[model samples]
Target: MKKITGIFLSMLFAVTLAACGAKAPAGEDVKEETKTEDVNDEKMTEEKKDDKTSAKTDLNVFAAASMTESLEELKAVFEEENPDLNLVFNFDSSGTLKTQIAEGADCDVFISAAKKQMDELDPNSDTKDSDITIDPDTRFDLLENEVTLAVKEDSRKDIRSFDDIKTDKVETIALGNADVPVGQYSESLLKNMGVWD
Candidate 1:
């Protein structure tokens, strides 16, 4: 998995370089825009004059809302490491990000919060829309997060576990939206515990 993650990061950097009209070098950074002029008899070729104009100024990345802090830190490091490229982030719910990509938004990378949202963007997905297609080779599980139960830091509530949510002592319980991945997991857990009807 570490090897795969390294490969994936390399691919992302390569893509960034390609987008900025630069070829990936061996452990070297692209510091400036390169312009190649085709001189025919000491005169610049018209077709090659404006090639640098096509160099992308930004690499757009769509990420889950939960990844905002981490991605922001990465963006800073990435931009500092690759001076020629800028990373632009679009953070939102995984489902929303998936929808945006399906709608033809310009995205160089996508980091989803859930497997269902990512799977829906996969080209081989049976549940995905026919018009939406993502190369299966480019997909990988990058992170895994555990579902946790939390309460206010200073609260006097006696809630300690899932079982406590059903007790009369606990007045209120907070949960994610039913349509989201977190909520789905919570629902499944409750049902398995025989607490969900």
Candidate 2:
């Protein structure tokens, strides 16, 4: 976990530094030259053709619904930098995304809020379902989150914490469904506290 966190931080730092750099002034003429005369012109032409083909490719990213806001913000910056590649996002519960992938939905990238969903798709994991292929090398923890109890400001409930919710002082409670990562976490917490029935 520490290693993954470190890698994520490093990547975030690199992206921040790159985004801060100034771009070359507009209308400036830039010259290009071959590194060596031995370079094959045909190979170069073929590579350029491949690049053009790939430029029209659409990258489908399936991610948890909770990441919608942050991913949407990054989408604008990423699209501006790589105009040729279009990123199509399908945001939903992690479990739902996993089911989509299992059903052979087109996805170039998958970001799950919980490791459970990712594990189910990871070919290397013990919990993995057969037929799903995931590149383990590209997998890394992106962020950590906390679950908290919230109440309306005008509410008269005397809830102060998870334990408080177990008391009769609170009448009704709202929680995410089991398929949602937040819901799973909340359920786990409540179960651990001997409050979930």
Name the 10 consecutive residues with the lowest summed lDDT in model 1.
1-10
* Model 2 stretches with alpha carbons more than 4 Å out: 1-55
Over all chains combined, what TM-score does candidate 2 have? 0.70
Candidate lDDT scores, in order, read 0.67, 0.73
Superposition error at 127 for model 2 (Å): 0.4
**Over 4 Å off, model 1:** 1-56
- Give per-residue CA lDDT, model 2, range 1-197, as digits (tens): 10111111111111111112334455542412232222456556666666554555467889899899999999979977876666778999999988887887777788999999888877779998747556778899999868989987887776678788877888877999998899999999989989888
Which residue pairs collide in model 1, if any? Answer: none
Clashes of each: 0, 0
Q: Candidate 2: deviation at residue 93, Å?
A: 1.0
Question: TM-score winner among the candidates?
Answer: 2
